[model samples]
Structure formats: C-alpha cells, structure tokens
Target: MTLDAALPALSSLLGDRLCRSKSELDHHGQSESHFPPTPPEAVAYPETTEEVAALVKICANHGVPVIGWGAGTSLEGHALAVQGGIVVDFARMDRIIAVNAEDMDVRVQPGITREALNEALRATGLFFPVDPGANASIGGMASTRASGTTAVRYGTMRDNVMGLEVVLADGRVIRTGTRARKSSSGYDLTGLFVGAEGTLGLITELTLKLRGQPSAISAAVCAFGEMDRAVAAVIETIQSGVPMARIEFVDAATARAVNAYSGADFPEKPHLLVEFHGSEIGVGEDAEIFRAIAEDNGAEGFEWARQTEDRTRLWKMRHEAYRAILASRPGARAIVTDVCVPISALAQAVSETQADIEASPVEAPILGHVGDGNFHAILLIDPDDTAEVHAAETLSARMAQRALRLGGTVTGEHGIGMGKLGYMAAEHGEGWQVMGSIKAALDPGNIMNPGKLVPPNNGAVG
Candidate 1:
C-alpha cells in the first residue's frame, strides 16, 4: 500500500539494480528546464520487458507510482518523479531487437536513442529521421511524440512510429499495431500510448518506420533583413512544394548565442538554415529555386554546404544552438516553450512573441522548425530572482494563449508533461475529460506517472 512497502520487493527482484542511494535519487530528480527537483524514492534498471512487467506488477500491488525514465533529455520535466515512487530507468534495456531493412522498419527496445539507432543504420542505407535535437531515447521520443528539424519533410514521431509493445499499469503486456505499413485494425492504440507520457502504460518496445538515405543532400544558411521576411520565405517555399528536408529559423538573439558559444561567425540577424534531400539533379533544382525565393525575400549572407563534412558542421551548430543559448547567460535556467500556429499566422505569432520577449525582464532566445510553423522561445531567467521566473512563466502562458487563439496547439512536439498540463483543458475542452476517463480505465490507481499528462485521481479534470 506504499512506496516503502514495495521497495524491498523491488530490491529483491532487481538486486543492486534497484538504486536508492542519495546520489541516484538526486540525479533522477533533476530536469533540463526550470522545475524544482523532486526525486523518486528509488530507481530501478530493468533489462527486459519481462522484468518491466514484473516491476510494474510489484508497484501496482503496493500502489506505488511508476515513472518511466529514458535518456533524460526531455525538456518539460517528463522523466522527473514529482510524486515519490520508483523510476524505471531504461538505460540497460537499450538494444536493437531487429532491423527489417527490406521492409524499411526497425524493432527496437524503448531505451535505444535516435542517434544510436541512426548510427547502427548507417550501413543499412536506411535511417530513423525523427531527430529531436537531443540524443533522447526512442522510447522517450515516442512518449513525447517528438518532432524536430527534419520533421518538416519526414514528419514527426507520430507518423514514424508504427507499433508498440506496452506494459500497462496493472502489469499486463499488450502489443498494438503491426509491422505492416497501413492497417484498418481495431484501434490505433499505438498512437494512444505514443504521446501518453507514460500515463496509461510503459512502452517496452517500438516498431518504427525508416527512410532511405538520400542520393544528394545540401544545406544552406541565409540571413534575413527582417524576421517577417524570413518567415514569409518559409511559407512561400513550403507552399511552392520545395520538399525541404529541413528549414529552421533562428532570431538575432539565438544567432548571437551560436556565434559566442560555437565560435562561428554568424550575422546577428534573423536567419534560416535550410536543407534539401533528393536526387542530385532534384536537390540542385530545389536549391536554385530556394535561392531565388530567398533573394526575393531580401535574404543575405548566403553560406552553402554541399560537402558531407560541411553539412555535418552546419547541423551540429544548429543542434547545439540550445546549449549555446544556455551558455549565453551563465547560471541562468531556461523556461523553453514551444507553440505551433497555422502557417499564415506564423508571422504574427513570431512578431508578437518577439515583442513580448523584448518587453519582458528576462532574455529569451527564439529558434524553431519554422517549416512546420512551429517555434520555441528559450526564456532564460535567474533562478534566484522570483520576479524573473514569474515573468518567464507569464510570457510562456501568453505564448500558449496566442497559439490557441491563432488556431494552433499549445505545444507542437513537446507532450503534455507537468509543464504544459494546465493548458490541456483549455486546448482540448471536454476532450480533456475524455482523456482522464481513459486514464482511469487503464490505471485506476493512478500509479503510473501520476501528476502528469492526464488529470489527477484518474478522471477528474484537476
């Protein structure tokens, strides 16, 4: 009936793998963004799905909260155990079970990271394209339904994930979907748990669709005289059917952070980092068309990367932009918030967000996958300054409200972890209540990652 009552049994089942040391608790408690550390009572490392099922059973019997932990790269306190319980760390379960290259799909343990999976697929001529900038575990990415720079072209994890093997709260294991490309099966249960944030169940394995390596690849960065022009160019390019593999936007503040942290000389102006993936001739044509569009939009400081090394460096810089922004203000924590609006309204959303940051007390760097009309603002704040934290929180709330007003979701890729839970009722309305009902049906005790995604006490809106 309690976490302490379940710990002894977990220790016996996992041996030393059930960690209760102060250091382990402290490590598992920390979050990437601005959340107070609230560690779990214990951490369990399960190597197999059978073990995960068993551990879940043990926790279920005692009504102990079971929080799934992946690579710990989540931004919204997704892995932190807000309520005292046992955190099932998946690091030991990171193994590629099977790679069906001919079918262009891979069956992998939830613990395997996107980077590691892509590295293993390098010789296979196929790769997993859902890169969320972080070397996050595939399980964690699926849990968040994550998307990133390449999502503009390849689509998000929601599209890439085909099937899942989930361990429900009561310890029963069930498989959803099939390896086949399309299905008219009973229900899309795979989709349900993909972004459920470990509320309904724990994902033990995933079957993901893959893409072949492109014959040609090219990346470029162009500076825009104005932010609106940069955003306008993105809308026009997407509307023109450019088939861009990636198109990212970074404002002047983010550009400065990149220059300072990565030692790259970028003009402190709104910039677009674009990439094209297709046949050699097709990519060339696309690049030329993109160039014309950029020129029409008054883009300058053109830098093209045709070589593999050059492209790698270009993306490395973009991927490291977040870290660079964090380094921009030493000792400051970021309250990173993202919102997706309709493409037509992106310019207004970005413009107003920029104005909000300009008027705010904290420094917030802006960057995102603008190709999909999704962007993030890294609101940096002095943790010790309550006023600064409050200001950042207010700005984040404003951003969410603006997105909803503009016909977009409060979050584009980031799931409804503890950070964005407040907006679910506003965004989903009565549908949010339906979600709580589903949660209650699946985990009646609310022992599965309680205080996240769904309402507390299973069915209540709260």
Candidate 2:
C-alpha cells in the first residue's frame, strides 16, 4: 500500500513514459484557477486503453490514487492529483478511430481536443459542436460535462457523447452506450461516467454525436444600456424560441476589458454576442426576430458580422473574454465560478449578484451563456492580498447559495472538484450521501481520483 513501491512497477511498465521530473510534476500540480498546487507523485502517459488498465491495476494493488488528465484546461482543478499517487495523462491516445459520415457520429480516443476533431472532420462537411472555448480535450470536456457558447443549440457533452470506453477503479475495462442512437438499456452507465470527473473511472475512448456544418452562419453583437435589460432580452429570446446557435452575455466591466485587450471599440455597456445557424433564409429570419426582441428590450449599437473573418473576430473576442478580463488587472489570479438557474429567475439572480459584487472590494467581470440560464463571474483578486482573497471567496459562496435558492445548481458547468466541495451537501442533501455510497460501491479502494466529486473518505481499502 505504498506509492513509492508502486512507482518502480509503473516505471518498468512504461519506461520513460513514467515521468518524475520536477518540471513535469510542477506543471501538472498547477491549475488554471485559484486552487493551490497539488501534484501527483508521478505522471504516466499510456498510449492505449490496455496500458491504462494495467497501470490502474498496478496502482490499485498498491492502494495508490489515480487521477485523469486531458488538456489541463479545467477551471475546477478536476485533474489535480490531490492525494499524491499517479496522474494518468491521456495526451497520446488521441486518434479518431472512425467517422461514420452517413450516420453522423464519430468514435474518437479520449485525448483528442475538440479543435483537432473538428479539423479532421472539416472535409466531411460535419462537425462537433460542444465547444467550451478552450480547445479542451474531449475527455476533459466530457469529464466536466462542459458546455459553452454553442450549447444553447447543439447541447452539452452529456448530449453529444454517445458512448465511452472506461477503465474502472480496480482495472476492469468496459464499454458503455453504443453507436445506435436510442436504446432501452439497463442502466445509463455512459451518463454515469461522463460527468463523474474520473472518480468512478478513467475514460479511454468516446463515441460522440456530430452535427452537419450549418449552411449559413451569422453573428452579431448588441448593446443594452442596463444589465437587467440585457438579461431580460436573453430570457425573452429563449422563451420566444429563436433557436440561437450561441447567445453570450458580457457585462460592462467585461466589455471594457475586452475593448482594452482585443482593441475593439465596444461601448462600455452590457452586450449580448449572438450567432445563428441554418439555411440562409432561416438564419436571416432568426437574426431579424432576435434583433426585434433585443431592440424592444432597449438594445443599441446593433453590429452584425456576416463574413467569415468578421464573425471569427466577434467570437474570438467572446472566447478570449476570460484572458481579457485577467489582463485588465496585472498580478491577479481569479476565482472563476458559474451557476445556472431557471430562465425565469435569471434576471433577478443576475441583478442581485451584480449588486453583491459592486458592494464588495474586488473587481469581478460577468459573462456566460445566458440562453441556457448559465453565467460566470471571474473574480479578479491579488493572491498575495488575504483580504481580497477572502472577499472573492465570500462573493463566490454567496453566488453558489443564490443559485441554489433560486432553483439552480451550485455549478452549472464547472464540476465539483476541491473548489466547490463545501456546497455539495447544501445542494444535494441526502442525495449527496447516495453519491458517496455509489462511489464506495464502484471504487471501494477510493483510488480513482481520490478526494473529489463524491463525499471525502480515507483512501484505504481493507
């Protein structure tokens, strides 16, 4: 039951693939957000599912923790090896196994990034649409159940991932779901592992749903004088069934930061960056309907992007909004948090959250996919300043509570890692205990990404 003992076996199994270098350890230890560094004792790169299963068996026999790593873009520290054993990185197993163009599905290895998958599919006239704005690996995106701008139309990983090949805690390799679209299957095992964040198993391969490239694409940005109006416009747009391909909201603070960073002249007002996809006529009609709704809600400065480069610029700015906000303040780390509430309560939730942030001392920029009732706050804080950190923490906690109070989740897309563990009980109640029981049933040794997702437990199997 010793990690030190397990390393030699892993090294023998992987040779140079098992890395213990300080630089690699330090890199894997860090996170994109504010969580402290918690690196694993070693990092193992397995190029095949069989290798992963063997490595897991070795670690399980030694009572060692096993954490999964994809592209390392998760904001929730989902991949950090907190319990200190081995981090199984899936960077090399990135191959598109098959692309069923007629059936419109693709089977891929877990390590392929969304961007790479789409690039490979470009000639097929079909594409994957679950973009989380980071070119994140499909495995990491599925692990966190991630969604971003296009989620309003094409849905999240839960909808796009048709099946998975998983390496369980005790080293059993199994496949869940199938290429067939519908089934009366016994259990939704694929659903179970998709968002489990590698607690139950490590994902080795995935069969994903694909959508055809849109015949026509149009994007636009409109400004609203007030945040409430901007939110109200989003609510109405969703309710009216505009079928928006992507609808994102950015507050004045975000607009200011984006303007400064991207060198685009966006008036310092709350803005909705939107896109529509369909037939040429259909997209035009949808854009017009949305424009009417936005204008009715007091939107101004209606700027449209029809050409490829212009629309790319518009979305590029939206996708890079996080870095832009970070650039607005030098020497600052962020506590990036998000929540999803019912579309009806979105205005109230956003308004109250804005008030709370304004009253606090730290500067936090607000943005998200408002069309799906999800939004994010990037709370910029000087990590060295304890008071600023505390203030940001308080704001984040309050936001989680507010989401729950309004019939929502503590995290809309960002899964529970070390950052959001405190609010799990409040959100799930006894249901949280059921999750722990399930974890115990599946991973009795608690070696699969110990200290995450399910309730905490001593990582000991007796």
Candidate 3:
C-alpha cells in the first residue's frame, strides 16, 4: 500500500474529518515517553461508532493501516502511527451515552476522559477508580490496561471495563461482554481486546464499572530509614489483608526529585504514600494495621493528611511525581518501563533494581504501586547522546527480564506497545504465538496499527 495514494481516498471518504497538516501530524506523532516522533499519513476524527466503522472500511479497502488515537498519553508509543497510516483520533467522540447510578456502570464514548466521567458522577456518590494520573481517555486506558495507585482495591482496566464496542480491521462492528456483570459468556474476546493495544480493533465505546465514594477516607505518608524496610512494610500490609485502596512506594531519590519539583518537603528517604477508603470503622482498622506494619518495618517520620483538601493535595503531588522527576534533571528525557512481580519477590526486585541503577551511569528514579508488586525506573536520558539512550534501554530490559524470572510480567498495566514487544516471547512463550494467531484472525490484512503487539508469521516482529 503506497500510503500517499491512500491519503487522497481517505480524505475523500472523511472529507474535513481527515487531517494532513504538518502541525496536526506532528502533534499526533509525538508521545509522552521517549520514543522518537513518528507521525501517520493523516489523522481521522470519528464522532460516532458508525463513523469509525466507515473509516475502517475505507482503510480496509485501500489496504491502509489504521491507528487508534485517544488522549495521546500512552507512555509506550501505543498511540503512535509508526508505519504511517490514518491515525483515528478519538477526541471528538467525547460523550457519555448513559450513567446508570443504580447499576454502577456508565456507557461512554472512547474519548470520554476519566476525570470528566468522575465529575458527572460527583453528586451520585460514585466515581470511577482507575486513575492512571494522566486523565487518560477511558478507551485509551482500556487499550493499555492502565492501573494506577488505586488499582490495589478497585482493579485495573481489565476488571473495570465491563464491555467494549470495537470496529474490526475490516470495519465489522462487534460488541463484547455486556452492561450486566460477570458472564461465563463465549470466548472471552473482551479480555483479549482490553489490552490488545489497538492492534486487533479500534475501541469506540466502553461500559465501565463505577465505585461508590467511600464514606471515610484517610491518606498518609510513612517514611522508612531504608528502602528495604519500606518495601517490607508494603508486603506485611498486603499479607495482613488491609485491602489497601492505594499503596505507593517512592525511593529516596524519587522523593527528593518530586519534592524539588512539587515543592512538598519531607525527610528525603524511602517512603510509602498510602490511602484507606471504606466505612469509618473499617478504614480506621485498616490504618491501624498498616501503622503496626510500618513501625515493625522501622518506618519513621509518618505524616497524616486527614482533611479532604489536604488528602487531595497529597495524592495530586504523588500523581505528578513523574513530572517532578523530569524536572530534577534539566534537559533530560526518560525511558520508563513498568514490571510487576509476585508480592513476595518485590523486596528482592527493588533491592536488585536499586543496586543495578546505582551501578549504572543513568540517573534512574524508582517508584511503583508497591501493593501490586509493580514498579518503574525512570531512567533520565539525553536524547542527543546515543550512548545514554542505549544505556537506559539496557537497564530497562534487564529489569524486565528479572521480573519475568520472578514469575511476573514485563508490563503490569502498561500494555505491550512497541517498547515491550521484544519481551512478549520471553514472558508468554508459546502463548505469545497464540496471541499472534488471534491477531491474524481479527486483522488479516494487518491494516490495523502495524509494528505492534503480535509477532509475524515465523518469529518475533522486531
């Protein structure tokens, strides 16, 4: 498919909906993380499911690649159209179809952001709990299976997304799962597509599970003398079964970086920022149990944020921790990779990773949703320095392999976009090949987002 030839037909089909301007292409090409800008031939804004289906159909006829674009917050280049096709920007599809407060679910367009949905649910005493800190579109979140601090209790996109309206590569519209809860159902296609990274189909609409706002919420930070102690505290808390709403780990370096950037001061040491949400008594009990665990692990310098405003400020700072890290080092890009392991192996993993980082030249900051055994090392890089980029990638790859050895995944929430595609075979082995077969079945022409997720016929795509 000569991409230039397809663009004229795409423009004809989409009319003003098609974008090919330099600025628009540049904007769509870029990503939040360190991947180099790779733009598509054009960007398409589809307002409705039928619009998306029609767009896909046109692309299919021309053997043109189609990439799904959401809020463009993907850290792993999942939204980037590297092969140069039509980028279906879903921003114009922002709308809430229905909000069933009693059913505890909402029907929304792919572009409806998590923050917007929460705002609508404000008076209803219910909120969607999947907070990736980016205010990512619900569709994008589902595509990448993003989970943030609150995932310990509320679950990831895989759990919250009850159903999805997807346009197949050939423009066939299919609805997977249902608004009603749990179904033995058929082949579990919904699970397959939730984290497919848009290689199989374009997610147009989503039915999301909602959580009731807890009656009593408490947020606090506990600092430990050492990273080992802080990690131990997390393990103990989880093992003791407090059902933590959010439990995050920030290494001393990360704490210093975020504090410098966010202007929140504390003793610069390994720390845990935790939240408890439940009935008044239940939250109190969970906090008590957590306090005991922290003290046992030699945690000190504990600070409590009791008021709602104070709690929000605390969490907001934590969410912006990534920005803070980038600010600490002027003129540096980041290579961020997420890996999750068994809870029992978290301490070893963190210790080994910290050691590896300290031994390396790259300035790496460690942080994670510790309760879920998921963490990331944000390796600061100088884009102009090829050596620095390679070093950072080496560190990320080593840690990913280590996580797999511990019976973990290369990416816990961040889906296998372009970056982690290499590790798919190592993590899934034969099952990874099975995934490619599924992709072949769904997208025979490979007209969907190319150079991502599934491998080629014989071996790895890379």
Candidate 4:
C-alpha cells in the first residue's frame, strides 16, 4: 500500500483534475483549529459519484488512505490528511440536485454549504434549520452529527438528514433511508453513518428535511447578574416547555470579546441570547414567558431585536463569538471543549467550569447552545509556550471528565476527530470497541478515514 503507486492511477483517471502542486496540497492540509498542517500527497476533484467510486476503487487497489474534504471549517481536525494519500476534495461536486417543496425536503450534493442551500430555498418558503453557526457544508454537518442554537428546537443533523448517498470503502455506492419520513425496514444505516466521521464511508449526497419559514421571528439578548443565574434561567425555561427556537449562553469574558471584535455594545456579564419562531401572537407570548423566567432568575438589561435587520445583526454577532474570543488574545491558538449535561445539572456544570477557568493560567471563554445542555470553553494558549499549552490541555481534560461525571457526553457536536480520541474509551468503554468492530466490518482495509472515530489498527497509515 503506497501513495507512489496510487498517484499514477489517479493521474491517469483524473488527468489535470488530480492535483499534486504544493499550493493545493498545503491548502488541503490546513485545519481551522490548532492542529499543525499535514498535507496530502495529492488532491483529486471528482465531479460525479461514479468518479468518486472509481477514485476509491483505485485507492483500494493500492491500499492508500482516502480522506474526504468539504468546506474545511471543522474545529477538531476532522478533514486533515495526516496520512500521505489522495484527498478527495468535493469542491467541484457542489450542486443542489432537487428540491421537493411538497415533501419539504431537498436533495443536494455533499459539498454545498448551508448558506448556499438556504439561499436556494429562500423562494420556496422552506429552509434547512440545522445551523451550526458556521456556514458548514451539509455533508460535513451530517458527518459530525452537528447541532447548534437552533438544534434546541429543530434537532441536529441526526434528525434533519433524512437520507444519504454514500460511497463505501471499496467503491460501492448505496443509498440509505427514503424521502418518506417513517421507516421500520432494516438497520438504521443512515443514523449509523451520520455521526461516523468518515471512518466507515464517504457521503456523496444528502436529502435533508426542511422546515417552513416562520411567520414571526423574535430575537433578544438578556444579561444576568451571575453565570449561574443565566444557566438557571435556561434550565427553568426548558423545564417549563417554552419551545424556544434558539437559546445560547456566553460568559462575561466572551461578551467582552464580542464587544471588542464586532463593535457592539454588550454588558460585561453572563448573557443569554435567545430567539423564538412562530405566529406573531405565539412568538410574542413565548417571549413574554421567557422574559418572566429570566427575570425570576435575576436577569436584567433585557433587550429585544424585533426588526429583521436588528435580529440579523444580533445573531451575526453571536455566530462570530469564536473569532471574537480568539481576537481577545493576540497570537493565541485555541483548544475548544464541547460538553453536554442534563438540563438540571447545567448550573452546577457551568459553575464548576467557570471556577476552573478562573483558576487556570490561560484564558478560556465559555459559550454554547445551553438550551440543550451543550456548551464550550474555548481554551486559548500561546502556541510557543509549552507550559501554557500543557495548562490548557489539562483544563480540557478536566472538562471532559466533568462532563462524564455529570452524566453527559465528552463531545456534544464535534465528533472524535484527532482531538477527543482519548476520551472515547472513558465515555463509551465497551461500546467504543463495538464501533471498531463495525468499522472493520464496513472497511476492513481502514482506507476510508484512517485513525479517526474507531479503535487503533495496523492498517492506519497516518
């Protein structure tokens, strides 16, 4: 199994579509997060599923690694080509195949970004609701089982992705699920592959469930006296069954960072940015109820953005929170921590996490979709300072342990790429081994995506 042998066949098949230039290789190698660049030997741009199948067959023959690339926005180094092989970049395969407005679904190629899909669907009065803050590609979102602020209401990629056209490890194409919603047929292969993180196969197409555009949309930002109060408000809101469309939490440090980066005025206190979608009257009633709950939890400085421009500005600032946090510390890289606990345990979880960050030597800002008991602490550290990096790693490990201790998950949305592999055993134990067994069954050669989301094996070439 050698990349040298595979490149000749790939070049013969793709011609100029197969890229070996250093610039393209370096571009495909870079990650958005802190992982150092690990470039692939070559990058192949396949425009069709048949081409993808043929590419995989060629790689399988040579026993070379194949990694899929979408928009390259993943945080945990999900698409990095650590092993030197051919990276199947999906940039050319981006196309919205069909939109079945009557069925409230859309069939799309794997490379189309979420923003593009929504833009295409705007005229139909339907939209895909699984927004992960980033304009991430639908394929990448499904691969990660991603969910964000709207997931508290519309659910995650696991719920929105109705069907998938996947290319198996050995170049076979198969479709899972149907346009119709309900199914009792066979194993839930769609669900299995949704969060597999490319260890099993590569997703080529997706049929995503869409929701109707709401009549009235309302967004607001409310500040609390303390972090616990903001978290408590979220718990009470969920327990009260308010049906919130979105509810995100950001600590004081995060708010300050956003203020500095986005040029917006925000109180330097723990805040909950929330949104509601429904009929005009219904949305108003829900906001009233949420306001009452927040007030009960000692929330103050409540401000609503009722106009369309105001709402867009508010959410835009919230989506840019990660960059804002990074901007807080110049020349600092981040190790993002994603953890989710039961709604009832959220207050204690955030409290302990805030206390830990306070004690740490590095700056770690807390934020996330708290309505679903999911949150992140972006741990910033000087890349050159080994001691600072170690401190940040220790904080991340403790956060993972705390999430498990609180009966939650080590990863809420970010899958086990290269970052969170160590916590898999602690989180899933025997089940983790079962995942490896399934991987072996689907991809015996381990060429799909080596050294990710499964147990270690000799076939790993990275």
Clashing pairs in 4: none
Q: Write the per-residue lDDT of candidate 1 for residues 40-131, one digit (tens) a residue.
A: 99999999999999999998888888999998877888888887889999999899999999999999999898899999999999999998
Cα lDDT tens digits, model 3, 159-259, are: 89988899998889999998878788688888888989998899998988998999999989989899999999999899988889999999998889888
Q: Which of the two candidates, 3 or 4, achieves a greater TM-score against the reference?
A: 4
**Deviation from truth (RMSD, Å), model 2:** 1.1
lDDT of model 1, residue 441:
88
The C-alpha local distance difference test score for the whole of candidate 2 amounts to 0.92
Q: Against the hidden true structure, what lDDT does model 1 obtain?
A: 0.92
TM-score of each: 0.98, 0.99, 0.97, 0.98
Residue pairs clashing, model 2: none
Is candidate 1 or 4 superior in lDDT?
Answer: 1
Report residue 316 deviation for candidate 1 (angstroms).
Answer: 0.8
Give the distance in Å from residue 183's predicted Cα in candidate 2 to where it truly belongs. Answer: 0.7
lDDT of 4 by residue, 1-462 (tens): 698887777888899999989999999998877899889988999999999999999998888889998888778888887767778888888899999999999999998999999999999999999989898888888999999989999999999998999999989999999999899999999999999888889999999999999999999999998999889899999999999999999999999999999998899999999999999999999999999999999999999999999999999999999999999998888999999999888988899998898898989999999999999999999988999999999999998999999999999998789899899999999998889888888888888878777778733333
lDDT of 1 at 254: 93
For every candidate structure, what is the RMSD over all alpha carbons to the true structure, in angstroms? 1.3, 1.1, 1.7, 1.2
